[model samples]
Target chain A: MSKTIYIAGLGLIGGSLALAIRKAHPTYRILGYNRPEKSQQIARERGMVNDLTDDFASFAPLADIIILAVPIKQTILFLKELAQLDLKKGVIITDVGSTKQEIVAVAEVCFANREIDFIGGHPMAGSHKSGAIAADVSLFENAYYIFTPTQFTQERALTSLKDLFKGTGARYIEVAADEHDRVTSQISHFPHILATSLMLQTGDYAESHEHTKYFTAGGFRDMTRIAESEPDLWTSILLSNSRAVLDRIEEFKERLDEVAQLIFQKNEPAIWKFFNQGRAMRQAMEIHKKGGVDSFYDLFVEVPDEEDVVLKILELLRGISLVNLHINEENREDSHGVLQLTFKNAQDLATAEVIIKNNTDYHITIT
Target chain B: MSKTIYIAGLGLIGGSLALAIRKAHPTYRILGYNRPEKSQQIARERGMVNDLTDDFASFAPLADIIILAVPIKQTILFLKELAQLDLKKGVIITDVGSTKQEIVAVAEVCFANREIDFIGGHPMAGSHKSGAIAADVSLFENAYYIFTPTQFTQERALTSLKDLFKGTGARYIEVAADEHDRVTSQISHFPHILATSLMLQTGDYAESHEHTKYFTAGGFRDMTRIAESEPDLWTSILLSNSRAVLDRIEEFKERLDEVAQLIFQKNEPAIWKFFNQGRAMRQAMEIHKKGGVDSFYDLFVEVPDEEDVVLKILELLRGISLVNLHINEENREDSHGVLQLTFKNAQDLATAEVIIKNNTDYHITIT
Candidate 1:
């Protein structure tokens, strides 16, 4: 049996999802909807759409699964329009919105007493680059694809949706809609707002002072880099999750006060404990991006100002393939350097560790 | 006519400064003082000290300049001790403390109406490594070295201190002590506190929630990386600049509240304007600061994900040196991996570029 899946938006997220779905289920017809005259032929010619139509109300009824991958406001509008349209029985409808509470609420009301299953999704992956031209199959690869499944959502619909998105190679996680909204608010929405605020405050200070511009370090840069992201996009994200974002700010202010009070009282040990906890947590999550400590082994070797030390290490491990090695030139001296070695697998890492230990008397630390 | 300059505390910063100063002014007799035991013999054998002494008071009378390269607490203690029995005429004293206000205040009271001249200094750079052996001359190179000068600071003394530190290759910026503390509290001290707080809050959130561990992204990582810094050093810094830090937090809360209110009221255009202003300011200042960066040569090579490929490049560049090399782990699976090589100067990069091109059939780009 073949299925017709109508994807509403063909921008980066939607088009990428369309490609991933089409690739996963070759028999499923991916119906791409647009204004018909707006790049309709070009999108189909590029093979992103198996079938193209301008009439979503006419095409939505045929879609077994409907994906609303537009911006939040547009997605809400589409959900209302989708609610009014005649839809297929046992259809699974999902939207890839950053915040899920509003979308899930709208979805639940719209799909109530109907045969349709509404499951909210948030593919927690993004790029500064946007639009139809930026779509790619591997955009969601290795990323976390969250599904906010409410009590109204049918179990079988989620399974089918999961099967459909298997080609995306994203790790699937299921949670309540409110839980999803809260987490997104803490990690994404609140951080975005704080980054922007911090940047604005720092900028104002810099403008008023002479040569405060010279005091920036890599930390300042890292803290404020997200402030340069798309303003309109962030505004939508923050507003969509306004309640939770506001809660986060309130909680953050409390936490900030706790730390500031400690600083003001000169409670040195308490300050240390706070940062130490932060360090411990950050360290525990350091190898997370590379899929845990067992997967990627990092070996750091301090090499005294001597020629051919790094070359010798390379020679010893010539037969065994390693991941990466670097000398941080920014802090490196003309005579002294540190060799940072990384290995992909445990076996290779063990072999490299043994070889290095046996061959060199240099101080080595592994993390 | 070699003048004796006394250096106290030989840690990473102190040792590095000693190495740099000795390299620049070889004729200057660097008197190293300890109880004339411990690592005194080892440090002298390593050439970090020339003339050894058991008493700083005895050593103080013979020196033309004194450097307190110790921690903030230790530096302050030494400043008070030095004030009691300092006899050298026109002797300039300086310190390498992260926070300057407290140290300057102590020195102001200690050396008031005396022939001693004290100018506060802070080299805004650091590494995890500590102790005498961990020092590297290039640690301060390209880093910002700030001078906090006051009305009591003699112009000639300032010039002499600047001349001495000319070997560090750091960009010198002069500002008042209070101004220094204010700016540093905003950029360094406040951000450190906030990052640690953010991490702790997120960690608490993660602890309470199930499967929230998978929700982290690059932004989260960037915001929390500074939290991994040494807790004790940050504790001292925060306390030393507590007044300014508290003021900063007050100002930051106002800014954060402004953004939060805009978000809470769902003022779309106003929210957009806030972020837009942030983006513009961040962009403008990013360019303003980075405009001073020296040109570094970059070379990119596309390598297949085969065994021993990176090794081959390393082996080829064994004789030919490189400044930095990185395998962009993000897009490594884009059929082939690209190796990014950076060089401080053109000659080494040119040699490596030629060698890699001639040896491999992979696509190479030089920038």
Candidate 2:
């Protein structure tokens, strides 16, 4: 028996789910429907789905499972439209929305008397890039995938739905919808707001002093990278979770004010204590490897800032077949360039350290 | 005749300068001094200086050039102490202090009726790791070395000072004392405060919601990297440039408030416009190559998240002798992993793209 899976919205998440499902269960037929007619064609050409349909009413009745991978507002509107349709009995419906409380609330009302079962899902994985073109079959691998089951959701239907995502290699976790919203708000939504605010502050400073922009090094750029996120997507997300985000913002403001007062009073000990606490807190956090997060073991080498010094070091690393190393030369121009060598894991780092120590006179420190 | 250069403070910056001078101009004798009696012995063992002296009175009169590589307050005290000594005729003096205005003012008074000359210098280079153990001879190559000369500064003395640093491969730029303070406050000092504030904000949020720390990604880590800086060093810097940093903070607060207002009102268009402007501004800034700043031509590739997929790609790259490549697997656990391949230059990036295109089925985009 070939299971039919209908994915509404052929964007990064939707398109990727389709690709992963196809690879995991080749006999299953995957159908995709996107708002922009052109995306359906692109999705098909990329082999993201086996079929594309223009009629949602006809498509709604055919799938054993339906996955809504649209914006939060759009997901609600689509759910309402699906409620009017005669969905298949024992059919399972889920969504990959960032926020869950509002979406799950809509699902309760829409499927109150319907045979379809709804599960609210939020995949904690995405690229900085978007759309079907950026989709991949293995995207959900090792990523955390949260599913919020409604009170009316059936055990068998939930099991079937979980089976559909078995190929994704995701770590499935269950949480209440409200808990989902609150947790995501703290970790994801609030950070985005802070990143944007920091960007605005930096932009304003740069406007007044044009030369200041040139002086912004890695720290400023890293702080503001999230500000370059797609505005339409972020604006929608911010508004959708406005209440929770706003609450976090208030808390953040209080903390900022305390630091500001310390700076104003020129209280050296207080400021130092504040920063020291922050440093310890930050260092204690477990490094996340999913999304667009970087994970590398860093090796700091104290070397002279000569033109060919980095090249010579790279050549030595190459001699040991360690080609994946990155050389950070930010300090090379000012002082003895402390070259930062990045490796994938501890074993590789340890190996590189031994090689450098034995082959060269440079002092190395593992960070 | 050999030129004698006395470097006071055998720390990272000062120690590195001594090593570089010795490497580039071996005949020029380098003398080192530090308040800690033990540091003099360590400095000698490291070969950072040709000689070490405990008596400043004797050391001050035997040099053609004297570099006070100490903290701002210590530099001022050292200058005052040197003023009392019977210094040699035409001895050029310079201090590698972070701030210049106050230091230059003190230098003016200290050298008023003395034969010794003083020029304010701030080498725009340093690493997170401090002290002589982290020093390297090539630290200043291609780095900007800013000098703030007092009104009484002699051109002959300035020329001699410039000649002493010729071997360091630094680009010398002269700016007024106040100008140096204002510009540095905008670029360096103010950013540090903002970074610290952000860290504190995040820390507060994490205290209430402990799980939030586990979700912090690359952006959070990068933003807070500077926050991990030595607290005592940062406290001294922030205090020395308090006035200018405070002014910048006021400007930053005003901008942040406006952003807060936009978020509070859910002004979609305004928020969108703000982010869009910030994105443009951030992208326009010159990419710096110091510290842990990334400086590589990036190529984004879409590949499945299988266990050996990245290894396979690396193997392919290695076959082509592409050893200086950095693979950023930020999205490996989600969607198709968009691996960012970093190359040394554009030409190398182009070559890798061609090789990958010819060898693999993956789609690549140069960013």
Candidate 3:
């Protein structure tokens, strides 16, 4: 019989991974160890795994691989508990937590000479939305999966963990656990902290300016919208990765100060050069392998009120033979509407215009 | 015959306005004065206006409105030209620039006659792309259009200009040009400068780090994507709006310093509170009107390659239909590709899932 894979904490990351592994390796028996009854049911119903239960011990010894996908605090607690468990000598253990240095330190300090082997993993797949409700089997598809293999990390366990993610359509990158935390702190965590801080300052002044209500247009919303992320999760990440976060924060300060000084000196040429360099650099950076950066353009749409106008337009464009068309009604507002049409070439836009104008009386324009 | 409207520069903002004004006010004859011969041809071919010409003199005397949408430096130059021309008395003159204080100052210093009324106008509408090719009339449909009226401004001229923008489906706001510059420097101009500078720094670092290829995700992309905007234009804005931009840069520095101080002190509680405050304020803030703030979820789409697959899914979804659909053959990458489907609610999601799984062999998932 194939080994059973046990996923502790059946939330977005865990549940989604369960589903992804099941599809990729159908012969493997997947078990979910969920604390909440609702989470277990959600996991089972979503076809995340073959079985679900709360008894960790009964399955702990039987599991070939165990994935810990929980908060940083909870991860430490779970590691503490798992360290004392009677496990098979070669059992592989891994986690999907944002911060790794602290967790790796805890593992080394507490689980010395443990039968089970641990490897730190962080798949750079995230969304502002959380919980099992947001879980989808394909979340990790095409995303970069980082493996932080510490000096204490067992080689075989790391290989097994990488193989598991490889089956899920994820690309792998390896780094030191401490280095992982530091990199994310500079690139990810620090940006979140800076965004939140900017938001706080904007809020302090927002109360006094009513015109700011109208002024916070597309650019402002895009720049500051990340500020609305869950505070608890960010707080946890910041505390765990304080050193890295502070380092990036200081770096950002220096960059900002240079701009201030240039502006203060009234060096128009220097300021212009500064602005030009940034624009060129931003334009030149190659896109990452995963989903491109989140922009305000992704979040803003105007929805127009109408029930049948959409269907009428679709019928009008039936002759064009489009591969796909997407519309979202939940986020649609009362006065504006967004229609995203995919075309094989620029010629299709012309066909779309005629169809939209001919079938629907509402004004339809190409984006 | 209705009054003629003369637009300078014939770029995105100026050309789009000409197109929208012609559509909304059919009686109005629109004429474009583009510097480049190519721009005039493109604008005429795009039907952005009824007439496109290089002769500013031909239309200058007969115009009821003159919109100067050129670069700020050119704007001052154009003002000098308009100041010398035999222009109609009480003919309303307005501009569509990001910064207002500097332009307002120029108007006060140069055009002191008060005979040629200059109501400093700024329509807060922009796109990541640029030039006449990317111009669209609907870009400013729901955008905020502000008029910075100084002490010498006439009441009737201000009212007339407001009516003109109302015709273009824009809401008008009033503010002192200096105040407008200050507020925008904080919200709009400063963000642009910061985004560009950060991107430049990252780009500089990318040259050394092998992992630079993987860092462009989430907030980094969104924060820096705007940095990919037009360089010469941004450089001009920074030089023109130096004081206000510097003030904002200082404000951000102070905020960064406060966060850094707490980090050094290990004050987790204070840092957490600061993040929470930002989250709360961003959540409570309105989506439109003030600072380009908007809701975050409306921006992106997850699409697949097959047409029948998407249509089958849409067919299953009750009451939810597509507004437009096109198949882009040139843009296709994978064989069993994703299709973009937009739906109204949970029922639509459920119905679509059933159809997708039942009809197509490809796996279907909602983002």
Candidate 4:
């Protein structure tokens, strides 16, 4: 028996993982440890886990598996405390944090002679929303969950932990702690930094020119929505992952400057060509089959009279492969005997039109 | 009695406007004239307008409102031809194009005789998928429709046309043709260019590092979806709106450089403060009631058992002043429990999370 698993800091990422684990292994016992009475109450009320406790002594001793899903500073503090506490001898321990090298380094020093095993993990899943209330079981579905274990990491324990996340729809990848931080900084953290900058630029511009209110639309909204994320969390991410984030920011700046220089030269053709190259590269991205993760591509669509229409539209959309399709009849309706359809793909808009022209009286349009 | 309106180039925009006009004013005759025989056939078959024809000369003589809903190049050419044509006196000509200043400048020269007034109009409504086949009447609903006219523009004619556009769910705004182009270039064109560049960067990185395949998700997809937009249309937009687009691109690059410098210096606190400023600005923007033309803030949500749940949720959301909620449901319970709720404010996602927590049994989580 895998027995019960105890997760410290039952917040957004931690609570969500508990739900995911529950869904995948319904029979397994899951325990949560969090600060404040409300989070523990909400976790129990929401049935996010089987049990909750604030005491690390009692919780850590009876666990087959333990996960530290807390902030970097707190996670370090928790590791130090856990090093002194009485924990199950053969227990496997993991963590969910944005930065890995720092935490892993702390773990190495704290647990060197303590028989405690530490394997760092980072789930690429993120949202502007936060806290225990935001936790969902499907958060890790097919998301690229990475495990960073140092040379001293016990392979058997790491393998067992990896097995726990198997059916939770998260794909496991292994890398050095430093490399994980570096790669994620480039791909994830840097983008957030850039997105914040874009929003601030517009905000500064808006302060001076009142007319910006009338001008900025969907494009700006989508670009800046993530700007609303928690400030402290992002602060930690940037500070801890500064080196890698800065490197990627430089890469972005280089590209941006290239376009700026071309514009300064009044090279219209070159500018168009540059933008064209970007457009082509974007279009060529493999947007199909993201495998059950909470991907932005999973824009649920409402298409009325879905059964026949979905099949026909799917047939026409064979020209373009889509990652996932879920039909919601409530969001869509056949207005005046016209089947209204929505899709996640640009090509699907054309495909929907093709299907409508061939079969239904549906007025297919992209929203 | 308002006489028949003639729309040249019966493509998506023109055809849709013709349908909207007809729907809004059922008594008025809508005429569609296309140079392409196939498009003419499509227009007639789709009943896009009451009368469809290929002979522009014959139709031009009888038109009360002449809308140049054609390609930008052709729109200028037709304006020149209309300057010489023997048409109904006081016939107002309007255009539907992305860029306005160039067209208005050319129209100023073409229609030197203010008798045949050419007012530049752009309904910021379109789909990535377009053509005569995809044209529909309701495309302009709740969209931002702007009319850019010079000092010599006929005010009475502008009002008459505005009356015709009334009740189409499109709010009309007046702006200078040059200013319109400049502002949209920053808000619209620059974002598309930025998105394309970002996508290209991802592609280049992915080609070199296979690990990027796992990293790409919602944030990336939303950032790049517009990147996959019609390349040919973008080419035309970039070339025509070159000056404004280039200026905006430079502005974006400057901002990007600023952010890169901050990140490079590892200024974590500055990053947080800057991001928070943006967050507050974006949050304030959610107060706009009309939700603008590009459907920018009007994001729809779809979830299982979303109909009754979303309606009840909308009722709860109505108590909040920050967001405008619109929930469409006619079939009620007979309708599948799935609901599609469209929020006039993007910031409503945070609020909606609160509502979902209170009302829905189906676990609503975002991680």
Question: Model 3 chain B — which ten-residue stretch has the worst lDDT?
Answer: B292-301
Q: All candidates' lDDT scores? A: 0.79, 0.73, 0.69, 0.69
Interface RMSD of each: 5.0, 5.7, 7.1, 8.3
Candidate scoring better on TM-score of 2 and 4: 2
Candidate number with greatest lDDT: 1
RMSD of each: 5.3, 6.8, 9.2, 8.4
Fnat for candidate 2 (0 to 1): 0.43
Reference-based lDDT, residue A92, model 4? 82
Candidate 2 per-residue lDDT, tens place, A201-251, comes to: 656666766555555556666667777777777777777777887776666
What is candidate 3's lDDT per residue for B23-53, written digit by digit as tens? Answer: 7778888878887666677788778777766
**Which of 1 and 3 is ahead in TM-score?**
1
| RMSD from true fold, candidate 1 | 5.3
Report the CA-based lDDT of candidate 2 relative to the real structure: 0.73
Better of 1 and 4 by lDDT: 1
lDDT string for model 2 (B1-367, tens) is 6899999999888988888788777899998888766566668878888888766667888989999998777888889899888888989999998888888888888888777788999877776646776576656665677889867889998887777777666678888888788877866676677667767666666676655655555666655667776777778777777788777766666665676678789899998787777666556653323332233467778987555455566655653323244554445435466666666445667877887899999989864
lDDT of 1 by residue, B208-321 (tens): 875556676777776776888889888888889999999889998888888888877889999999989999998888632441222246788888877667677878887665
Candidate 3 or 4, higher DockQ?
3
* Candidates 3 and 4, the one with greater TM-score: 3
